[model samples]
Target: MTQQTLQRPSGWIERSRPAVQWTALIGLSLGFGAVLFWLGVPAAMLIGPLLAGIVISGNGGKLRLSRHAFVPVQGIIGCMIARMLPSSTGGELGIHWPVFAAGVLSVIVASGILGWVLVRMRVLPGTTALWGVSPGAATVMTLMAEAFGADAQLVAVMQYLRVLMVAAIASVLAKVVGANPHHAVAAVTWFPAIAWLPFAKTLALAVLGPLLGQRLRIPMGPMLVTLVAGVVLVHHGWLSIELPRWLPAIAYAFVGWRIGLRFTRPLLAHAARALPRIIACSLALIVVCGAIGAVLVAVAGVDPLTAYLATSPGGADSVAIIAASSNVDVRFVMAMQMARFLAVLAIGPATARFLARRATANANAAAAAAASSTDS
Candidate 1:
């Protein structure tokens, strides 16, 4: 009958709201699955929830469009554009130091600038903005954000959304210019060899990445782990892994559903005040990065569009899809995409720590001033 006893039970009930959580989880899963089915695997590369997150997070408008609806439309447009890029181009654009340096520089500079703007505006916390604008894999950002105590979900969503938008726009432009986007040719089937080495390596890397992410406080643990492992496997010739036909679609759907779920009125209100700045900063970064990437492509004597897609801040899968469809070197595109992703993932936590430290120092200074005034 005591007041404390009554309050404790109510708090426990609220915490144990299994029904609501389950509903959200199941709804998200199904919604994501449906999006994959609707868009088809190849098209879904840009249709995922992460892509939706960008639009949702960057939405400055009053009207609320369901991410579910928007992602598919975007994907369709992206796919159409991807279908227009050349299926094969001359080999003049081989990877080299200058090209690599340009890509790296663009990503770093753009990501830093966008992160600084977002944090200064207070639309999002510094760490969250850094992770969100890191221009890496969505999963990497998420894991790093979690380790750094930023809102991982928000960062992941926003980063993915930007990827979708960029991919869609890029693809469309490529097609409009009369590029030849070709479908992937079916590979010769090899009998499944019972190779334990590849599977074991992949599993080990996956586990290790998360552990390192936890210890080092990296974001998007699973993604970082898988990407690193995948690269190692490919490099060692232990695995000739290609993304499954269904994966891009599935990834996009899950991303889209996750984004849609965050579309509540209250969150929208908060995003409104700072949405314009966030969008402007992100767009500026993209344009600058794209221009640098274009220069690198021209210097390397490679197709400009391929280089642009590779260095673009869009998701790796989407870029890969565009590369594959357009006859660009899939391996080269994936390699660069992975490199960019790793760069963003690795830097996110460090950037966050630095910003957080500065913020803490300022707060401490303010507190000291307040105490001195009180004494006076």
Candidate 2:
């Protein structure tokens, strides 16, 4: 037979590519998410997709969810937070400015202490330890760690581990404290009302939010942008809408997937070795935050559920999801999270650098002492 006649069809392979990718993405994310959701995992949509992303992407296949997809997802979440924040549905999240301020400061201080402890114990590199334990701004810390001489991958691993731990722990805690998120959404009948106009309006604003955020140089542009617009519109009484609950679930999944996809084989190995330390560090932060949360309970007059959600170490989107379902004050929780997030962004780098230097000096001194003893 002629060589050309015997050649396998490259066209078939090309045609199969997209189909294969879609099957993997849908099957893995949905399969995992559905099972976990049924099992009563908090933010199951996010967690399931996140875990699946790690498994699928980590293996050999690639899922083709576009980066641009995050914009609307974030926007949807933002609107939801704004819509539910001041609603009359949940418990009164007393806005105790003084206690809230104290809580924010406490979270930062506690995280810094843990970061130093990590450095001292050699749990992680200096910069990585510092930024990893910072209270908020995981994405920012991961992105900026390299500039401050931290291993970006290691920082990401640490940050994400804590995030995963916090989400898991906090979800359980929310239930124990009577902040049942499912019940929180039970009354919100605006969801599942899928229509074109409202969705389009939401999308337009969501799309515009990012464009404006890009122009304004806002960190975490899409979320903050749509978020600000939503809040502003709500107060002015110019905008009113509710998004399909499914969109936010997708957003959560995307967020988790984004973090999970970064876990490369070598990075996974490093993370595995450091898993115990990472878990310990994460638990330490939660303990400290929990203590501070107690103070918030007494001083703020806010329910335990709201206080805990506000002080939890995860990002705003995470807090909001739990808050929305648990009947915590979504607005108050967002405010606290955003404050901590911004605070970490501003001070985390400097603190990390200082701690990194201290770590190096300590290592050098220890090595010198060992050398002197050996020489003698």
Tell me the number of clashing residue pairs for each predicted model: 26, 3
Worst 10 residues of 1 by lDDT: 81-90
List pairs with backbone clashes in candidate 2. Answer: 179-326, 181-325, 181-326
Cα deviation in Å at residue 259, candidate 2?
2.6
TM-score of each: 0.54, 0.83
The best candidate in terms of TM-score: 2
* Model 2 regions more than 4 Å off: 1-21, 64-67, 87-95, 125-127, 147-150, 179-196
lDDT of 1 by residue, 121-202 (tens): 6667545676677776566557867876776656655665566567666656555442443332234122344446644543
Tell me the alpha-carbon RMSD of every candidate: 10.4, 5.9
lDDT of 1: 0.54
Which candidate leads the pack in lDDT? 2
Give candidate 1 misplaced runs (Cα > 4 Å): 1-98, 117-128, 137-157, 178-270, 359-376
Tell me the tens digit of each residue's lDDT in model 2 across 67-111: 577666777777777676554312433545666678788888888
